[model samples]
Target: MDRNLAIEFVRATEAAAMASARLMGRGDERAAMAESILAMRSMIDSIECRAKVIIGEKGLFDGVSLEEGIEVGRGEGPELEIALNPLEGARVCSTGGYNALSLLAIAEKGSIFRPPAVYMDKIGVGPDARDVVDIRETPKENLTRLAEIKKCRVRDLTCVILNRPRHVNLIREVREAGARITLISDGDVAGAISTCMPDSGIDIIFGEGGAAEGVMAAAAIKCMGGGFQGIFRPKNKAEEKLLLARDIAPERVFDTEDLVDGDIVFAATGVTNGSFLNGVLFKPWGAVTHSIVMRSQSGTLRHIKAEHHFDRKPRY
Candidate 1:
């Protein structure tokens, strides 16, 4: 994949987020997501690239329609595999809650890890703890160790996790361990990156989310110099076959670098308020998007606040 092709994908995501953020709290998430998906699709259609949806909300083989998939690169760019969560926190956007985002990650062909569409147990650590936190350890003990490593009070540490039943006990343990809790309705992608950005005020992320997202998060963490570890949790025999069919080893433990390698770029546009970035805001003049685009090879993380003028509608 041409490294520059990543920017085109980012632009398409920006367009999608702009269209989606307008629907927040409007009592229509599917419509909002559909609009975003369409906008993304249109944008991707304009790209000059060949890409595959290696890891996306839909199963791997299902191509994001001109109305689906996270909008990727120009139609004729690089032959890349994309992992996308078009609207990562649709519920949050619908309720005007928090942590909604339009996310996408691209890797050179065959670089993305393909796991069963199952749950993944993961632990994310911030720059403060660096190599100190380990997923193999008890979550409670890891919190304590992280606090010590960071030289901060346990209460000062913030743990982020998806607000789900599976995480209830983990939340309680983190709170009991004296770490602050920041539960998100969705968007573990943002939650994972938050730990690495001190400005985001999140110190760690623990618990489970989709296996594909775990790998995507791992990619970003690798670029940001954080720590992430995930173990895949296949739900059924079919999901198990999905992995085996791909020739994926069932017992592999995926670290950040394993998900994406070579020249890599990641961009996220916030759809609702969250730790890493504020959601998109539409103004009288145009639409504004808050995004963070990072490249692992260059160690560059650019916080971009971009505006697009939709002054004229395109003619079909």
Candidate 2:
């Protein structure tokens, strides 16, 4: 993929964030998601690349074209695979909560992980704590090793996890292990990526989340030289069958490299305020967008804050 497309992709995220922020706190998740999909799809089609949707949304909020195998882009550049979530946390956005964003990952063919859309048991940590985490180990054991490496007490470590009933045991284990916890409402991609951010107050992430979002988070974490591991967790016999048919072993632990390794591009624009990125701010004249664009080949990450004029904005 062209390096210039990094910024171009950010444009798509920006457009999506801007469109969705319009309905923030409006209690209309589908409407906000619909606007985000349209805005993002338009920008993606304008890009000069042959993009395939390997892991994407389908049949919800009119995002049918984002389904797996659907081809996007202008059909003119490097053939790439796109794993996208135009609206990562629609419920969060509707409630005016945190970590709502528009995110996408672009990589070479066969680089992004795709596993039948089942939930993934994932562990994400920054580069410093990378060597200490094993999903198979107890949270106490991992946290102890991490604290020893960081030269901090066990109680000083902070872990992040999704606030779900399935995590009741996981949460209890972490608390018992003497590590603080930050339970987020949604946005697994952001939750995982937060561990890589120095000021996000997140040291590690452990829980089950969407496999597609795991791939996206792995892409971002790779760009930041972080550590990530995911194991396919099939919830039913049908999903296990899907994995078997694809030759994907449910026990296999996919590291960050296994998930996304080649030259990669990741872009995200915040839709609602959060620790990682600020939400879009609408002004009397127009709006302001905060976005981050990353490229793995050069390990370059750019934070872009742009001011948009209502009448002069480009094709949102």
Candidate 3:
């Protein structure tokens, strides 16, 4: 795949973010989501290249996706795998909350696993705890281990987890461990990315989320030299069967690099407030976008603060 694909993907995500941000805190969640999803899908369709969506929400065959697995490029280039979350936190956007984003990643096809879209249990850390965490350990145990590595008190550690039923026990464990807990309603991509950013007020991310997001988060982490581990969890027999159909084993573990390999680029535009990037800010002259674009090959991270002016209000 061409390195320039990242730039193109960034542009698409920025457009989607702008559209989604318009719906922020509006209560018309379905409309806001529709606007963002349509913008993203339309942008993807315009790419004249064979691109495979390795990790995404349900596609066309499921009746939810408008165009699923559509090929874009005709040239015989590297098989490209694209992973996307048109809006990572629709709830956040609808509520005018935080960390809703438009995200995308492109890599050499077959590098990313076509895992069933099931929940994934993961533990993530920054460079400080890369070699210290294990899945079998308790959240407290991991915190203590990390504190030992960083030579900080357990109270100094900040653990992040999604606010959900599955995480109640995990959050309690972290609290009992004396580490602070940062609970988020949605946006695991932002949560995972937070672990790698020193100023994100997040020391590590633990618990479960969309398996596809694990792959997308890994792509961003790979560019940042962060650490992440994910184990696919098939919730039921049907989902497990889907995994087998895809030739995925029941108990496989994937690291950051394993999720996204080869030369790749990951980009995200904030639809709502988030740690890595700010939410889109609209102005009279134009709309401002806060975007993060990174290239894994060169480990280049670019923070793009751009303003785009349109001839008129965006229709549809």
Candidate 4:
């Protein structure tokens, strides 16, 4: 893919963030998500690529989505696969919480993984600790190993995880192991990617989250030369049967390449401020957005702070 497309991708995320920022703290998650999806779809449709939604909001059985599998873009450029979470933390955005974002990942055709809408047990670490952590290991073991790789004590490492009932035991183990923890209400994709950022103050991410978000995080990790691993965690017998029918093994660990391969591009625009990126700031004249766009092919990372003048750019 042409490097210029990186900025074009950021536009899509920026549009979604700008549109949804108006509803911040409105206590309407679905409304915020709907506006974001529409804005993202509009901007993405104008891009010069033949794209398909490999990972998106709804499943095939749900019969609703941004319709996943529906082709996007202008139909005039390279064939691509997209994994999008237009409003990654809808609940957080609605309640004016942190780490809300509009994110997307793209790759050449057939390069992005299309995991089912099921839970996935995931573990992520930065490049420095990439070869040390393992999903098959217990939380304590992984933290001990990562601390060793970083040449620091376990107490100096900070792990991120979703604050949910399922993570009670994991949180306990991390605390017992003496590692600091950051419990987020949502947006694990941001949590996962934070491990790769030196300033993010996050060392690793451990927990189960949406498989789609896992794929998106894997793309970002790949661009950062970090490490990520996930195993299918079927919720029930029906889900387990579905996975088996699709020939997906529940115990199979999917590494970075298994999730996304070849040259990849990842972009994100923050809707609400958090550790990695700042939230959109609306102004009388326009709005300012903070975004990060990266490509694995060239290992280029760009942080874009853009000001959009509504009068001059009515489309925004």
Best by lDDT: 4
Per-candidate TM equals 0.89, 0.97, 0.91, 0.96
lDDT of 3 by residue, 130-246 (tens): 889987777878888999998999999888788999887888888888999888888988988888888888889999998878888888888888888888998898998897887
Can you write out model 2's per-residue Cα lDDT over 1-316, one digit (the tens) per residue?
6799899889889999999999999999988888888888889999999999988777545543577888999999889999898999999999999999999999988888776647999999998988788988888899998899889998998888999999999999999988999998899899888899988888999999888888889999999888899998888999988888988876888898888868999999999998779999999889999999999889898999999898886534
Candidate 3: regions farther than 4 A off:
59-68, 73-79, 245-249, 312-316
- From the highest TM-score down, the ranking of the candidates is 2, 4, 3, 1
Residue-level lDDT of model 4, residues 103-145, one tens digit each, is 9998889899877547899999999988888899998899999
Candidate ranking under lDDT, highest first, comes to: 4, 2, 3, 1
Give a tens-digit lDDT track for model 1, residues 148-266.
89887788888887889887788888878888887777778888988898788888889989887787788788778788888777889998888788776776767776667666677
Better of 2 and 4 by lDDT: 4
What is the Å distance of residue 208 in model 3 from its true position?
Answer: 1.1
* Model 4 weakest 10-residue run by lDDT: 58-67
- Name every residue pair that clashes in candidate 3: 48-72, 49-72, 49-73, 50-72, 50-73, 99-273
Model 2 residue pairs with clashes: none
TM-score comparison, 1 vs 3, better candidate: 3
